[model samples]
Target: MKITLITTGSTADKGPRKVAEYLQKYNHKLEVIFYNENELRQTLSKCKNTDLIVVSANVATHKRASLLIQHLKKLKRPTAYAGIYAALHPEECIKETDLVITAKPAETILELANRLENFQRIADIENLRLKFNKKEIIKNA
Candidate 1:
């Protein structure tokens, strides 16, 4: 799956980088992009087909991270927040994201990805059922 990690502040932040590295190690096929806050537009553009978005609030103000999350929400994608700020203010992060990773961010994100993949599969099955029912109705008519 394609995962985007957007960090608040510069690339000097180690928290998000570590998360990205961990994720890469977990699944080499995973396409992960680490972007700074200033690259919001580029991140949004690349997120067209992204499966998940993880925002890191390392050393930046909560307000800045919140605003970034809000912008990402407009894309209607599943978003997760991490880093110390997220851990300290999970409630605030939760307000803007689907999940807040207080610890073991890489593991939590992988689990969430699995759940989402399964959910999509279930939805596909349901759609097939609907299509089959429609065909049966047409045959009866």
Candidate 2:
């Protein structure tokens, strides 16, 4: 999966990078693109193969998250959010996310890595289902 991770604050960047490095051990094909708010918006417009988007809660109360959500909704890509405010402001995050995983700096990276792996697994299953359905249709045709 190609994941675009948007970092709202300096703190958010470290966790995603660590998670990406950890995930690389098991799935080297998983590509992560780190972006700050401005870069993320611009990249979103051009990215064609993005499978998922992860935003950090450091963006709390900022319009960046809302704007990104609108774009994601239009693109129909699955999204997730991770950071301190995720749980406390679940309603806000949930509006834009398929999953919200809350964690502090201590375990944030590890938790995000695990959640991303699960997301990948689910995507794989969905892809296989689509492939199987297409095969069935071809056979019947």
Which one wins on TM-score? 1
Per-residue lDDT of 88-137 in model 1, one digit per residue for the tens?
A: 76655666665667666766666666667667432221101111221221
Prediction 2 global C-alpha lDDT: 0.51
> Each prediction's TM-score against the native?
0.72, 0.59
Residue 26 error, candidate 2, Å = 1.6
- Alpha-carbon deviation at 48 in model 2, angstroms: 2.7
- Give Cα-based local distance difference scores for all models: 0.63, 0.51
- Give the Cα error of residue 112 in candidate 2, in Å: 9.6
Q: What is the lDDT of candidate 1?
A: 0.63
Predicted candidate 2 versus true structure: per-residue lDDT over 4-26, tens digit per residue: 66555564357667766765565
Query: Best candidate, lDDT-wise?
Result: 1
